[model samples]
Target: MEFDLDYLVQQLPALRAGLLLTMQVSAIAILLSVVVGLLGASARVLRLPLLSPLIAAYVEFIRNTPLLVQLFFIFFGLPSFGLTLSLFWSGVLALTLWAGAFQVENVRGGLAAVSPGLGEAARALGLTRWQYLRLVGLPLAVRSGLPAMLNTGVSLVKNSAYVSAIGLQDLAGVAFDRIASDFRAFEMLAVLLVGYLALVLSLSAAVRLLEHRLQAPFRR
Candidate 1:
């Protein structure tokens, strides 16, 4: 049988439309994950009463488990609790939780890098705790934390493909559907692989740009 480039080209619009959903879910999840990460990281950093241990437990459980299994638990296991969410929302929630676990680790690592000297120096100079953290610790910590967070965000976008197993029509899901419809599994999969590669490469470039703008002059 002859290959049909026209047919795949015709499917581009639908595929791209599917990509939009992936973008939406990934964006929301990243936003939520960052917020959650900040809260969790702060808990650990502040050694907040009993809260820190609970947050640590959450991070450990999520990090130790396979993400796909976690997705299955949310999408499949959640139903047993009589709490149902749509496929899109479920995908978003699952990704947010998974990403939050890693984000917590990154934020803590960065925050830890804020030297004790900075805090001591600020105190010696009569800076208030809030002012010292706001001016010195937070600024430096957040700057150091950005690259790892961006990398994790990239992973979340690519891993959103796993949502397809639960019937969400993310980019990979649509590609799978097209392959089934056209009986061109190899051709369609190759395109899917390249499409993902392009999206990730573009995202990585954007991350580098942001890093450049933030860091300005090279430290070397």
Candidate 2:
């Protein structure tokens, strides 16, 4: 089958819209997930009496379950319980919860690296536990866990394709829709691969740059 450059070019507007929506959803989810990670990690690290075990359970459950199942539950199942979200918010919530689980582990691992001496010192200096965590622990932990967090961001971006299942017109959804009508599997697939590759690579480059800046303080 001949590759239709003209057809691909003609589809650029739809592809562009899809790409924008994908990026928007990913950005919101990634940002929110990081917040969830920080809070969840802090709770677990501090061993909060009531919250820590529940957070641990949440992390484990989200990590263990399939994201698609989670997505379906949020988008489809929730309506049965009298709670319904718009497709965009539903996608964002699903991705945030899924990535937030991994981010919690990543940030917790970073928090675990904090020296016991520091905690003792904070206590000696009369810093409240919350103050110590916010002023010292989280800053250091976030810096340490940044790479892993960024990796989760990348995965979330790729996983955004799954949002299409809920009828969101993200990149993959647009491509699938076009192929179904035009029967141009080769063209659509090829463009889809390239679009994802470019998006991931761009994200990776940004991650590296951010890492470099964050680690600069530790450099000789």
Candidate 3:
């Protein structure tokens, strides 16, 4: 088989478009995941009456199952109950829920790591539960979990490729189409690999920078 560098170059435009779509979907899903993680973590930490168990079950189920199955359920199964979503929204929703599950545990672990003395001190200081969480708990949990959050972000970006399985025009989807047209499997797959690597590396760098900034005060 011949390596066709020129053929890969010719497909750059489509691949670039696909990359942009992947980034857009990933950005939205990551944001949603963070929100879900924070809320779920808080519920578990506080032991909210009924909500905690539900969140726990959700986290367990999502973490245990394959994301592809979740995506298919969202895109295909929901229509059976008359709940339908567009392909892009379906991908985004599935990714958000899936990532959120792992993130919840990351945050919960961070919350658990908080020293018992701190909570006691907050109570002794007459800090309400809400204030204690906002002023003390949340910051500490986020700081301790920053690395895990970064890992989740990177995972989310890579997993966005799976959206291609549902006919979303993401990087993987576009590459598959191009490969089908030109029959340049090696070249297209190589480009796909490189594209995801660049994305993950860039995201990891940005997260590391943010982590450094967050740690600045502690260094002093």
Candidate 4:
């Protein structure tokens, strides 16, 4: 079979639109997941009574279940409970919660690595728990956990493809649609691989830059 350069060129507009949609969805989800990770990790580490145990249960549930099931439950099942969300928001919410669970553990591990002496010193210096976490502990924890956090971020971008299962016209969805109509499986699949690779590499590069900056103060 011949590679169809002209066919791909003709489909560029649709493909680009799909890629942009994926990027938009992934961006929103990544940002929200990071917020969830940090807050959840902080609460658990501080042992915030009811809230901490609830976060632990949430993390376990999300990590154990398949993402596709979660996606379906959000997109198809939630309407039964009168909590309907648009397709885009549903995808965003599912991805955010899924990735956020792993991130919570990743961040919690980093927080655990914080020296016990530091917490003691913080108290002796009259720094309240929240203040110490804000001013010192969280910064150090984030630096230690940056790699795992970014790994979850990269996975989040790739997993954005799952939104296509619900008929969201993201990159994978567009490829499947074009293949169904045009019968260009080779071309469409090839394009899908390239699009996802581009997204992952872009995210990895950004993560590396962030890691370097975060490590700078301790590089001496």
Q: Where in model 2 is the C-alpha error above 4 Å?
A: none
Q: Which stretches of candidate 4 lie over 4 Å from their true place?
A: none
- Candidate 2 lDDT tens digits, 1-220: 9999999999999999999999999999999999999999989987999999999999999999999999999999999999999999999999999999999999998888888899999999999989999998898888888888888998999899999998999999999999999999999999888888888899899988988998898899
The residue-by-residue lDDT of candidate 1 on 2-48, one tens digit each, is 56788778888888887888888988999999888877887787788
All models: lDDT? Answer: 0.86, 0.93, 0.93, 0.94
Residue 118 miss distance in model 4 (angstroms):
1.6
- Highest-scoring model, TM-score: 4
Off by over 4 Å in 3: none
Model 3 residue 160 CA deviation (Å) reads 1.1
Q: Least accurate stretch of 10 residues (summed lDDT) in model 4? A: 211-220
Q: Estimate each model's TM-score.
A: 0.89, 0.96, 0.97, 0.97
Clashing pairs in 2: none
lDDT of 3: 0.93
Q: After TM-score superposition, what is the CA distance of residue 70 in candidate 4 from its true location, in Å?
A: 0.1
Q: Better model by lDDT, 1 or 3? A: 3
Please report how far candidate 3 places residue 99 from its true position, in Å.
0.6
What order do you get sorting by TM-score, best first? Answer: 4, 3, 2, 1
